[model samples]
Target: MQLTTFFFVCITNASSTQFWPGFKILLVTVVVLLAVKNYKFLVLVSHALFLMIP
Candidate 1:
């Protein structure tokens, strides 16, 4: 499930030509922290809203 969320988030940006490098870096950092912190529930739901980020 986490992998799915991560994949979607990354793929969403993958097609963009003007994506900001720092934004992607920050998102990866945040996702890692969320995973490390054991916030599974949040990580699950966040993806729904994450899809709307752009």
Candidate 2:
């Protein structure tokens, strides 16, 4: 529920290209932090994101 809401919020709020660089930086930071804790989890997330994109 919370995840869906967050996704919707991001989609709605980030209609401008200006928001993307910050979003990418934030996502990379998160992935880096997760990688430090569990590299496999980061890989899984990266794969999922890649598949979601194209």
Candidate 3:
């Protein structure tokens, strides 16, 4: 929920040319934080998300 809002804000604030690079950095930071805080939860969440993909 918060991540989605963060991503949306990041997108709306960034210029199109800068969006991808900025988003990549944001994603890496988030992944690292989640990894450090709870690797198990990250794994489960990622697994569930992956299953949702077509």
**Best-matching candidate per TM-score:** 2
Backbone Cα, N, C clashes tallied per candidate? 0, 0, 0
Q: What is residue 31's positional error in candidate 3, in angstroms?
A: 1.3
Task: Report the lDDT tens digits of candidate 2 across residue range 1-54.
Answer: 454344434434444335757786675566567556765655565554554352
Better of 1 and 3 by TM-score: 1
> Each model's TM-score?
0.40, 0.42, 0.37
The C-alpha stretches of model 3 lying farther than 4 A from their native spots are: 1-19, 41-54
* Per-candidate local distance difference test: 0.59, 0.53, 0.52
Ranking by TM-score: 2, 1, 3
Candidate 3 per-residue lDDT over residues 1-54, each given as its tens digit: 576445334434443334567665675466557646765646544654444344
Provide the lDDT at 21 for model 1. 77
The collision pairs in model 3 are none
